[model samples]
Structure formats: C-alpha cells, structure tokens
Target: MTSTENEAHRRDGADPGHRHLFHVPPADGGRYPESAYLAGNSLGLQPRATRTELLADLDAWSRLGVEGHLEAERPWLPYHGLLTAPAARLVGARPSETVVMNSLTVNLHLLMVSFYRPAGERTRIVIEDTAFPSDSYAVRSQARFHGLDPDTTVVRLRPRDGEENLRTEDVTAFLAAEGHTVALVLLGGVNYLTGELLDIPAITAAGRAAGAVVGWDLAHAAGNVPLSLHDWDVDFAAWCSYKYLNSGPGALAGVFVHERHHGDTGLPRFEGWWSTAADTRFEMTPVSRPPATVEAWQISNPPIFAMGPVRTSLELFDAVGMPALRDRSLRLTGYLERLLDEVTADRPLTVVTPRDPARRGCQLSVRIGTGNANELTKRLRHEHGVIADAREPDIVRFAPVPLYSTYHDCWRVADALAATVEATS
Candidate 1:
C-alpha cells in the first residue's frame, strides 16, 4: 500500500486530475499546473454526468407541467421513495425506515423531538466536544426547548493528553458511566476534523445498555463508509445527501427511525400532511394518522428537483458499491500515509487520523509544528497545485476519495508536500 510499491505512480509527479474521478480545482495553465487535489472530504468534485441529469429534469419539468408528479418514470409523488432503497442500502438500513427530507440540522431536530425524551434524572445528552458546529447548535437548542440548561444537560467528551483523537474505550466508558442520566447519545459517525471513524455499532450497543436512546449524525460517514444502522439497532440517524452521496449542495437530507419505534405511539412526533398515512392522504381527512414507517417524519411535499442528482449519484454508488470503494479508499490513503511518513521523517509533522482502516475513512489530518500550517497549505496550493484544506492553527486535512481518486493522486500530493517543505525551509 506504500508509495514505493507503485513506482510510476510516485515517480511520475503528475497532476491529480489525471487520477481523479472528475475535475480538479481548474488551473489556467498559469501556476502550479501540477497541483495534487485531496479535498474531496470537504466538498466532492461534481460528477461529469450531473449536468446531463439535471438538464433532463429541467426538460421534463418544462414539458410535463403538473402531470410530471404522477406520470414521469419516477413520479414526483414517490420520488422520495425512489431514493429510499438505494439510500437505505448505502447506509445499511431497511427501505421502509428511511426518508429523504429536510436538511441535516432540521432532520436532527425532528429526530431529537421524537427520541430525546427526558424523564426524572435521565435528562442529559452525550455528544463529542468537537462535533460540527451545526450539530452543537442543534443539541443546545434541543436542550433549551426541553427547558434544560445545555451546560448541565450536554456532556462534552474530549481526547486524552498527547492524543489528538478519541479512543473507542473512552467513548464506551463515557456511555457506561453517564448513560443513566443521558436522554440520548448523539455522535458524528465520522469526525469532520480528524477523519476519525467512531465505533457506531458498539457505541449504539453501549448507549442502549445505559438505557438511553441512540442516534447518529452520519453526515461524514454515509457514502464514505459502510453503515448497518438497522442491524446495529441504532434508534435513529440523520445525514446530508450532498457530500459523498453527490446529490449537490443543499440537497435534501435523509433520516432513519428504527421500525421498533414505528408503533411506539407513546413517542411524540411533530407531524404534518405528508406524514399522514397514504391511504387517506388525498382524502383530505381531518384526522391525522401517520404512515407506519419513517415516512411519518415528513412534514411537507418532497423536493422533486433534488431527487434527480440523488438518483444519479445513487446509481453511480450502486454501480461501484461501498465495499469496492472502501477498499480503494484504504489503499489510496495508506499509500499517502507511507509517503507522508517518509517526507516528514525529520520534520515535526504527524498524521492525526487513525492508522487502522477499521477506525477511519479516506481523510488524513496532518499536524505541523514550528510552522504556519495554513500558510504552508496555501503555498502548496498556489505553488504546487496540491488542493488540501487547513484547520486553524496547525492541521491540514487531505482526502483521496475512492470512486474517483487513484493511487497516483496520493503520491502527487505527497511530492507536493516534500517540495513545499523544501521551499519553506
């Protein structure tokens, strides 16, 4: 998996576009024309065929009028359903328990309303300290809505000294100790910063053992890795479809509420017309009896236009499959790691992401000492054409996405790093 094993890939020093699935940050053949791109973990490259699919949707809408809802091959009425099977498969859930709906934060709110039921002393929530800001906001708001102070109700876990990442043991122990008072355990499936993959299945089991509801924010994990939400007995989950799902920015997100929660009429939910059972939906009945599955969470008419790119993206995912993509992801990331190790052997740089494939995805966060990490990353982009991202004081995050990125992309970026080090020194 090391770069040395693939000489041509490492020795050629070519541009990443040649190894990527799609376009790179287009260079005008002006500066750093051979830049290596490794930023897909933040925003993925647009699929070349996405425009064609969007055009088809626009054309169909122009020609079909309102009839498109019921008449199109993928009728607008069941458009959300059409995306469910593939989306569910991508996340390892039953089709019936999944629904593509509001954005990530909104879905998190909806799931929290249903799952975060505080009673007696069990009124707190356990979340990571470094969760995405949006998630932290939602968790705080949920606590406020429930008339609890976030300082007391929200449990924030941090990494150990000299450790840039959270260990599974620490997470499990937190749940074991605080599960009793925790109303819900909400954690990101894959950390956005360090690209650390949390042990979701074991965490879910631990939360359940502590007698607390478990939910996951799969924003980073959905298409980046395989998920078995249903089999893991995950009580609920939410995800944005835009990332690796390739559904475009601000695309409709998705939610999964376990089937066991379906008939638990005792669990409260904020409902609307779309959640009303299908048989009586059009009857315009006054009584609101929700559908028997996760569709019960829908609060509005589905976004038909957003489904087009999702359908196309899911098709690509189905074609390649997660197993194959993850395999390649490991190889590409491992190659990059080895290259980085060699280049930084004498430097004070460290890879923060987990070395184990089972504990991480495609991302590797590089921490630099005694240098401006951000400036170096910027220099790498402007001088060498290596597209990576910097996080605050001293970390640079790079991701070699599988479906599109090749082993050569890894080496190109590694070489660019070596060159950048030489230039700065």
Candidate 2:
C-alpha cells in the first residue's frame, strides 16, 4: 500500500468505529473483501442484533398468539413505549413529546393537520427549493387540500444566484419580511441532496417570531447530527429510521410535538383508537379521549413488527450517544473531505456540500461536471466496490457513517475516483 493508504489504515487503528457490530456487504469488484460502504445517507447497514431480536418477537407471535400482546417478553401492547424514551433521548425530547409511529411523510402530514393552519392572508407554506421530492409533494398536496392554488400557496426559498447552499441569513431574512403570509415553515434539518445542515434553532426561532409554525423534516439529520428539537423550540419534527438510524428499509418513523403544543384542545388533529389514551383504549368508548402528549397525533396502532427494528436501532443510539458519534463523524468526514479535495483538484468534480463541518453532517456530495451521475455511480460500484448514492443527473453522495465507516473507506473513495476519472490536461 502507498504511504497515504497506510496512513488511512493507521487512523482506523486509532479510531476504530463500531464496524464489527454490523454486517458490511462483500465487494462485487476491487481487491478488498468488503465494499467501501459509504451510502448511509441512503440506507444503513443492518445491525447484527436486529435479526436475533426480531426473531424473538416472531417466536412470541408463534408461541403465544393473541396472548403475546400482553405476555411476550417485550409485550406488544406496550411495546411502542419501549421505543419512546430512547427515541426521545435520540432527538433530545421528552417522552411525552415523542412518539414512534407511521412513516416520515405520514408523520409530517399528521403533524401538519394540527400545525398547518393556513387562513386568510397567511395561507402560504414555506419550504426550501431543493427539498426532497416527497416533502415537496406533501406540501403541495396540503395546499390543494386547503382549496388553495398550490402554485400560489407554496413558497420555495432558493439559494442566491451562483451559490450551491442556502444561507441561514437569507432564510431568516425571507421569513422576517414575508413570514406574515407564511402560515407554516417546513424545512429539512439536513438537506437530502446537498448535505447542508441548516441552522435549525435559528430558523425555528425566526419562524415562530414571525407568527409562523416551524416544523422540520429531519430524515437526514436525526441520527446523523446532534439535535435538540425541544430545546430548539421547534413546533414539530419527524424523521425516518432506515438511514443513519440503522433500521431496516421502510422502518417506522419518530415524531416530536413540543410540550407547549400538547393539551391545546383548540388545535385540530385526526384521531383514531391509538390516538386515545392507552388506559382508556380498551374502554371501547365511542368518543376518543386523546392524551395531551404527542401520541394524540398517532392515527392508528403501529405495526408491531415494523416497530421492532426502530426500537432495536434506537437502543443502539442510546448505548453509544450522539455526542460521541458526532465527534467521530467530524473526524471521519473531515478526513474524507481532505482526500476528496485531492482527487477533485484535477478531476471534473466538485464537493457541493459546505466546507464548514458545522454546516453539514457526515455526508459529502460531489457534483459531477461531465458525466451522468447514475452511470458514474454504477461504475464506481461495479469496478471499485465503492458503494455510494447517486441523485440523477449530477450529484453523487458519500456518507462516511460514523457507526461503521472507516478512514480507509474514505481513502478508498478518493483512490477509486482517481483511478476512474481522467485528470484534465
């Protein structure tokens, strides 16, 4: 190995991540046995404990049948409660303020039902221009549901001309000036494509000051960065578990509703059997007596099996803690950025993510200048076994997940790019 490659291995030796706890996929190419998996922003590797815990739940179902609801080791009836504290801890929320249920978009919609009160002059919903497509769709649909023209009711904030990422000052300025017309401000905590970490607390404070409800879609930020939604005074937030959370695909999502919003009977929400207080659930009352907690927003009983992976994953977060993870993330991503700087210096690629570690997470997105991103990613995977994510025409994302990625993984990415892309003359 070259001196640089040897250095990477040495760094891994000193700061060995929790790689042994998870299964790394075998490489389809390259000399290494394991693929340099750097796609945690898209999907995380499966934790070894997931299968063992999942099967135990399955056995409970097979053995105890209906009785498993009460008799299973992790009792299905109150199983979701097992996740609440850990999920709450993960996002710096109170147990009453957090609930693990539904998918990310579903939770956003449910929270919107109570928070997105567009009326008269304030009938606009504000979102980032480059928001994930799902968020864009959800907000537009919400505007339509309110009998407002989506084109008119939805206001998308864009970065300044020639800028790749939106500035915090720009976003706050817009909210200050036009926020009177904006009934809701929903933004991603960490942008999906560019990997920019927005100033959540500042933005949330700005929106609330402007008389707009502020909620966050933290799909990319939840486990990737340190967040204190409750302390940030965010009105509501939701995040998926399949990515940085290390849960299986389509795993259940977690939602946070600020304590200030709880017990506000004036607020509107759609309710179901599960939305009511658990103590009164079996009373079979015609009218739902929903609790004052975030659970009131829960529309239905969560699928037990779906909750299993999320629970298992949250437990891991609790064990390791975000502070430690974030420290390692900074080190790991910084190393990757330095390596990428060297590779992209002579290639037709540019790291689009912010240079400031505080402005982003573990993810680093490279904008391809001359090739199809999808095709390039496929080549990287099949030829070099550098598993990364591609976003259509130009952006390729590489997330050196703090939980499993190594310094060598980052080196491999740089090394592979150097070998694949031709340097400019």
Candidate 3:
C-alpha cells in the first residue's frame, strides 16, 4: 500500500484489507479470489457474524418455539429494543426517538400518515425531481388519497438549468418561496443516483421555518454518513439497513420521530398491536393507547430473522463508531476519485457525484460518456472481476464502503475501468 493508504488504514485503527470478516463471493466463475465489490450503496457486504447470529435466532425458534417470545436467549419480545440505542447513535437520535421497524418505504408512508397533514391552501408536498421512484410513488399516492392531484399538489425541486446537483441555497430558497403551500417537505438525505449528500440540517431548518413538516428518506445516508436528526429538529426520517449498515439484502429498516411529536397523541397515525405501550400491549384494552415514541408507528411485531443481521452489523458499527468510519470513508472515496481521474484522463468521463467530500459519501458516480457504460460495467464484472452498478444512460456508481473495502480494491476498480473503456472505445 502507498504511504497515504497506510496512513488512512492506521488512522481508523481498523483494516478492511483483511477481507475475511466478510463473505465475499468469487467472481468470474470462481477464477478470482473475490470481486471488487463496490456496490455497498445498493447492497452492503454480508458480515461474517450474520450466520452465527441468524442461527442463534433460528435455534431459539426451534428449541423454544412459542416460548421464544419470553424464554429465548435474546427474548424476541424486546429484541427490537436491542438495536434501538445503537441505531439511534448512528443517526444522532435519542433511543426513544428512534425504532427499528418495517421496510424503508413502509416507514416513510407511516411517518407521512402522521406528518403530512394538508389543510386550506397548504395541500402541497415538496420532494426532489430525482427522488427514488418509490418515494415519488408514495407522495403521488398520498396526494391522490387526500383527494388532490399530484401535478398540482406536488412540488419537485431541481438543480439550476445547467447544474447537476441541487445547491443548499437553491433548496432553502425554494422552501422559503413555496413553504406556505407545502404541507410536507420530504427528500432523500443523499441522492441515490448522483451520490450527492444533501444538506439535511439546512433544508430541514428551512422547511420548518416555512411552517412545513420536514422529513427525509435516509436510505442512502443513515449508516453511510453522520446525521443529527434530533439535533437538526427533523420531524421524521426513515432508512433501510441493507446498505451501509452491512445488513443482509432486504433486511428490516428504521424510523426516527422527534420527541416533541411523540407526546402529541393528536397526530393521526395507523396504529397496531405493536404500536401500543409494550406493558399494556397484551391487555387488549378497549381504547387504543399508543406509546409516545417512534414505536407507535410500527404496524406489527418485530421480525427476528430479518433483524438478526441488523443486530450483528450494529454491534460492529458501535465498536468502530461512525466518526472513525466516516473519516476513513472520505479518504477512501477521495483516493478512488483520484485514481479514476488518473486512469480516465484521456477519456471523456465525468464524475457526476460532488467532488467535495462534504457533499458526498462513499460513492463516486461516474458518467462514462462512451455510450456503453452498461457494456463496460458488464465487462468489468465478467472479465476483470470488478463489480460496480450501472444506472440508465451512462452512469456507473462505485461505493467503497469503509467497513470491508480496501485501498487495493479502489486501485483494482480504476485499473479495470480503464481497461474496459479502452476495450469498448
């Protein structure tokens, strides 16, 4: 490793170079030791601890059966709470303000049920033009459910005519102008496509100042970046554990609701058996009394199997801590960007993600104007054992996670990208 790389590895006090902690699969039909797995922004690498953790839950189910809810080793009844504090720490929330619950989009809908209250002329919902399709679908459907037209009730924010990413000033200005009309302001904490880390605190404050309830889809930001949802005074936020959290594919997600909103039983929500206070949950009271915490938004009991990987992953995160991980992530992604610049010097490649570390996470999205980005991505995987995700048109996203990715991995990706572009060009 180079001196810079050695310094980065030592500074974090954790070496991702020893890849044994992750279950990296062989690429090119077992010809390579492992594929350069640079797609953590989509799905994180599975931790080695997952199997053991999952088996423990499975064993409890097998041995204790119905009694596992009370008598199991981990006690399935309060299993979700085990993740609450660690998850809250990850997002800079209090334990009571956060809860590990349903899927990402599901939590978004749940939070919106409580926060998206439209009345009078303030019937609009504000979101980004490049929001994940699922978020747009949720907003449009919510608008329709409220007897409003999305075309009129939805305000989509976009960059200036020639710019690729939205500026903090632009977002604040738009919220200032249309805040009165907007009932809810929801956006991605990080742009999934461009890899741009939005200014969450600034946007949240602006939205709130405009008298709009602000929330965020933290699917890409939750574990990848440092967030202070509580400190930022965000109304609500949701994220999945399958990304930088290192949980398995389709693992359970999380939600955050500020403590101020928790006591307001006047807020409308869709409650369930699990939403009631845990102590009185099984009493089956005639009246529905929901807890004054984020758990009140949960629709069902915890999914132990789905949450197993989360428990294992969060333990690792707590041990390493987000501050150190983020520090390493900035340097690692910066190194990747520098390598790409060197290799693609002669090519008409554009790094679509923000160049500044403050505006990006671990991902560096490149637009390979070569007209065959998908082809190049496929060639990189099949031929050179480099794995990166290809978006529509010509964008390829590479996320070098700080947990299980190494500097050598970035070098391999740059070399493979250079070779693939040369071959395709």
Tens digits of lDDT, candidate 1, 288-393 = 8897899988899887787788788888888779988887778778878888888788777788898888999989988877558789888777766677888878
Best by lDDT: 2
lDDT of 3 by residue, 176-222 (tens): 88788989999999999899999999999999999999999999998
Candidate 1 yields a Cα-based lDDT of 0.82
Best by TM-score: 2
The true-versus-predicted C-alpha distance at residue 155 of model 2, in Å, is: 0.9
C-alpha lDDT of residue 403 in model 3:
83
For every model shown, the clashing-pair count is 3, 0, 0
lDDT value, residue 343 of candidate 1? 79
Q: What are the runs in model 1 whose C-alpha is more than 4 Å off?
A: 1-21, 28-35
Error of 3 at 85 (Å): 0.6
Assess every candidate by TM-score.
Answer: 0.93, 0.98, 0.95
The residue pairs in collision within model 1 are 21-404, 35-385, 36-385
RMSD of 3: 2.5
